[model samples]
Target: MARHHTVRALLVGGPMYDSLYDRLPAFERATGLHVDVVDRLPHPELNARVKREFESGAADFDLISTHTKYAPSQATWLSPLDAELGAEIDDFLPQPRELSRIDGALLQVPRYLDVRLLYYRRDLLGGSSVTVPRTWDALIEAATTLTRPGIYGFLFPGRDSGLFGTFYELLVSAGGHLFDANLRPAFDDAAGVWAADRLAELHDRRGLTPRELPAWHYDEVSASFRRGEAAMVCDWPGSHHLYKARATCDVADRVGLALLPSGPAGIRAAYSGCHSFAIPRTARNRAGAVELLRDLTSTAAQLGEARRGAIPVRASALAQIRAEAAADPAEAHRWELLTRTQEAMIIPPRFAAYPECEDAIWHAVQRAMTGVVSPQAAVREGAQHIVALLARERLSPQPNTV
Candidate 1:
């Protein structure tokens, strides 16, 4: 029989945590372990606080819920779960598993997956003779097709980081590279210029939305699209569930999800992100924390999470999802979209300075979106900032072997 443990965790307070809280009681009852969840700050602020805690030698967190991409850099501050939970690591979905590893030792185990999809209005596309886009050019044209007096063609979050993250998939898909193998900035080349120009043109030429929409984050972008003010928008899967609920949006039935178009690289990349469970080195009960992680990642817990609208991180949970979809059509559609986009999802390079890079890139993109700077200038500045950050922090390209 597996050993039981009483664990403490500091979880980010948000919709995601609510889902975990709903499932925790059962896991606790089964394992004879108690879970104490503390809601800290928002995503960005929580990350900052974690850093401050580590720097000040006041690390009080046991298990920290965080993104997978930063696991490698954070490995020093995190304990290895691989030795304690090898079998559990093997059960994770490929993408989530890859994201969890840092120098062959898993620093984080994904609790959920975040994948992007194109959200569109079924009424507009079905009623009109306009065909949905299958390519970049076609996407722009379709945006025009859906644009009317009040309704805009596209509804993406235009803020620096929000829009930039989504746009990277397009840039990479379009044969534009952000960072080279040496971990150097490479977004100043010909392909980079073309990609940025096209993104900016969506606002300047094609009628997208709000004019100030670039300043909007996920919530505002999703709210605008769900309320039927925008025709097509690219967003995380969470939007799909929100729009489909009866109490959520009026256009739930009229909403349709599509696979984003493939770019010049012939690779259809979807901007993907994941949230994982990690144990900080400062945990008072490291052994107990790993046990809790093991239970949270079990097949049953993952399936429960999937049913609650988050993507399952375990491969076995997919079967559970398939069975549940057999009973619900809406869930079936959502699952179909996720399965199709699964391979196309892209994980950002895992680096200790990734958060800094992400924040810088987000700021640059926001500046461009708000017209404070040109897209070309924004990319150039972003590249410079990224390179300078690497130098300032002395980040290495590969995992430390010594």
Candidate 2:
């Protein structure tokens, strides 16, 4: 039997900060292990710190948790888990696990998955003429119809890479490709232009908000919804729980969640990503570290995590989401909406040039949203920047199709 010991683990994430505080007691009581969590640093900062640890031979953590998006380039620093984890992985959803793999090697063990979802004030639209939109055109029309002074029709985060990435997901769902399999820029097409134009319309023509809307991140926009400042927003599952809290929600029963409107392909679409756990190569207790990961992702651990509304990595834990809902009607409906969004989720391709590409896209989208240039012009400029960066790296663009 594998011996359990005191495993020191470092978790790097934001959503489950409070959940961990409440849930870890049981874990420690059962295993006699103490977990340490480091919150607040962004992904880039954490990556830099990990690199420094390896360079200086000063290891500080045995296990690390991060977003699944970093797997492709960060694989070198991750310990291979296939030999240690065994067959328990068959319980996780297929797409998340597939994305966690690097060259057929398992790089991380996923825990919870997050995808984009639409949140709106049902009180404002519920009894009124407004209806929750299911297509891009319908959404635009609703935004125009429901918008008024002091209240915006639609709002989405557009700040920095978060905003740009969300918009790019819409472009992909709209039948656009960032690059071909050959690593060549393929975003300068009608689908790409349409995506940009749609966003610009929300800002300029639809009266959603001025250029200031894009500056808002997920938190800001979600707060606006809770405060009844925005009529519609595209957000994640966290907002559902955040709004349900008695102290935060102004319209607790009035919040309605739905899938993002379908795109040109008539498909419900959302940008899906996973927050996962990985063992670092510099760990002093490799075997113990792997056990920690297994413990965290096991059916029991995952079920506990899902009890607090986290989308667990393992499929068996999904049943917990339903059971919890059965006990709480509000939670049941919210989770049902989350499950719908999950079905529509698509994981973005991870590449070495992901950060650079994200930067270029952010800048380009900002210029277009501000009316400094047309959508076509902005996308053209963004594509050029991406091409230049790729050429410098002696690589080409390789966009993944969902």
Q: Which residues of candidate 1, in runs, are more than 4 Å off?
A: 1-7, 27-34, 148-150, 204-207, 264-266, 326-334, 397-402
lDDT of each: 0.73, 0.71
Per-residue lDDT of 263 in model 2: 83
Clashes counted in candidate 1 amount to 4
- Flag regions of model 2 displaced more than 4 Å: 1-10, 15-17, 25-34, 42-59, 204-207, 210-212, 323-336, 392-402
Q: Which candidate has the top score in lDDT?
A: 1
Please state the error at residue 4 of candidate 2 in Å.
14
Q: Write the per-residue lDDT of candidate 1 for residues 137-217, one digit (tens) a residue.
A: 677777877788778888777764567776687778878777888889887776666566667667765646678776676
- Cα RMSD of all models vs. native, in order, equals 3.9, 3.9
**Candidate 1 to native Cα RMSD, angstroms:** 3.9
What lDDT tens digits, residue by residue, belong to model 2 across residues 1-402?
Answer: 222454556665444334544555676686666655544444545556666666687755778776676655566678888888778777887777776776677888887777767777887665548888888878888888887877788888766656776667768778887777766677778888888888888886656764477667666677777777778887665445676665776766677777678888676667778778898786766766776777767788767666655777677888767776788876777777787777776665577666667778878877777677898998899999988888876442222222
What is candidate 1's local distance difference test score?
0.73
For model 2, what is the alpha-carbon lDDT of residue 166?
64
